[model samples]
Target: MKARRVLVALAMMAAALPVAATAETLTNDMVVALVQAGLGDDAVIAKIRASAGHYALSTDDLIALKKRGVPGPVIAAMIESGSQGAVSAKAAFSADSPDPLAPHPSGLYLLSGPRMVRIDPTTSNQSKTGGILGYAFTGGIASLSIKAVIPNVTARVRTKHGRPTFYFYFDEATRGLSQAGSPSLWLSGPASAITSPNEFTLIRFDVKKDRRETRVGSMNLAGAKAGVMDRDRIAFDYEQVTPGVFKVMPKADLTAGEYGFLYSVSAGAGPGMWGNGTGSARIFDFAVHP
Candidate 1:
C-alpha cells in the first residue's frame, strides 16, 4: 500500500513538469530530485542521454550528488553527457578554417598565427650512456644515465614564441585532403596511436656545437630505466579540444632552446628508437627562439 502511494506521487510530480516538445536541460538539481523521487539508474541515464546536460560535475558537485543518493552509474552518465556536450561545442569549427582547433591531420602541429604548422619528426641515431664512470668510481654505488643525441645543432622547424601552443590530432579520419594528397602515414609510428598528452614528455635539449642532447634514462644498481631527468623535462598542460584532438601548452614560459616531444615505444627504450632501429621512439622536435 505504501509503495503504491509513493509511485502514484512520483507519477503525479513528473506529470506536473512543463510539457514542452524540446527536452529540458538536465542539471544537477534535477538529477538529485529524480533520484530522490525513486528513479532507477537506467531510467536516469536514459534521461541524461535524451536531454541536454548542463550538470555541475565538479568534485564538490559530485560529492553532493552522491550524498543525495545518486548512484555511481548515474554520475558516470552525467560525466559522459558533459564530455559529449563539450566535444559538440568544439565541433562547430569550420571544416576549411585554418584555425588550430579546426580539423587537422593525425600529427602534432604548432600554432603559428592563423596557421597550423606540422612539427616534423626527427630520429635520434646516437645513444650516449653516461654516469657509468661515476658508478665504476663509486663501486656501483652511483646510477648510470642514458642520453639521446640528435646530430643537428638546430632543428629544421623553429618557433619565435617561447611558449607556443601545439595541437595533436589523433583521428585518422581528419587525415584526408589536409595532408596535401600524401599517402596515409603515421607521423611518429607507434607514438601516433597515443590518445593522451601524458604519453609524451617535453624535454629541453642541451645544445652542442653540432648536436643537441637530452637525457632519456638513468640506470642504477637495480636495472636500466627510461625517462627524462627532472631538470631536462618541461611540464605542460593539455586539454581535449574535441574527440581525438588535444591542445597542449607549457605550464610556464619556456626558455629559448631546442625542445621535443619524446614518446618512447617501451619502458627503458629511450628516445633513440626509430622504426628502423633496435627499439621504437619518436621525437617531434623544434627550436624555440627568443
Candidate 2:
C-alpha cells in the first residue's frame, strides 16, 4: 500500500514536467523576435522582469537590440543582469538659461540629470562658419547661424522609465514657418524666413562597432505609423508642449537601444537662405538601457 502511494506521487510529479519546461528561457534574440511579432511594450517588459537569465551583450549587440525596437527600460534590465555595477538611473541635458554658446552638454546623460536644452540665437549659430569673406561681415553672416541646442551630438544618454520629454526654445519670429505649405508664403517678405519652429521627430539609429550611425527608420508621431526605410529602424509619436518646448514621449514604451530626437532648421524662402532645401536636421542621440 505504501509503495502504491509513492508510485502515484511520482506519476503526479512527472505529469507536471512539460508544463514547467514550457516557460520561455529569455534571451536578447528572443526579445527581438517578440517585438517583431507585435508584442506590446508592457507585455515584453513583463517577460523581461520575470527572466532570470544572462546575456552576452556588446556594443554591436546593444545597437542591434535598439534597432529591433526593444525599449530602454528592458535593455537596462538586461545590462543590469549581465554586468556588475548598477545601471545608472540618472539622465539629464543642458538647459543654458543664460549663455547659449557653450557646449550644449553632449555625451551620455544620466536620467536623473536635467532633461532640457536651451536653443537660442547665439547657441544656434555656434557652428556657423563661413569663408573669410563671410566671416568678415559678422552681423550679416551671423544671422545665418544654424545651431540647435543639442547640435547633432553623437552620443547616448540613459533615461528613466515612463515617458521621455525633450525641451527647447524657439523665438516667436521663427514660428509657424518651419513647415509652410508654400515657400511663396514665407518667401514673400525679407524677414519671412523659416526657423526651427519647435518641430521634432523620433527616429531609430543603427550604431556600428565604430559608433558610426546610420538612419534606419522614421516614426510618424501624429499618424501612429512605422515604416521601413533601410531594414533599420523603429517609430514613435511626439508632442509639442509649447512654441519652443517640445516633447517626444510616445504612448508606447521604448525598447532598449539608441534613438534620436531629430529636429530641423527650416530652409529660408530664398536660394541664399540658411536651410538645406529639405531642411538640415540635427540629431540628439540617446540610449535606453534595460
Highest TM-score against the true fold, candidate? 1
Predicted candidate 2 versus true structure: per-residue lDDT over 94-156, tens digit per residue: 333222221223211123343343222111222222233443465343222222232343343
Write model 1 residue lDDT over 1-290, tens digit each, in one string: 99999999999878877565457888999998888889888898999898887888789999989998999999999999987866664455342345755655467788877677777678776666667789899876798766787778888878899789988777543532244343333555575566778888998888888888888777666765666767777899999887777889999988888899987634334353322223334589998897
Q: Give the TM-score of candidate 2.
A: 0.31
- lDDT score at residue 219, model 2, on the 0-100 scale: 20
TM-score for each of the candidates:
0.58, 0.31
- Best-performing candidate as measured by lDDT: 1
Off by over 4 Å in 2: 1-156, 173-199, 216-240, 264-281
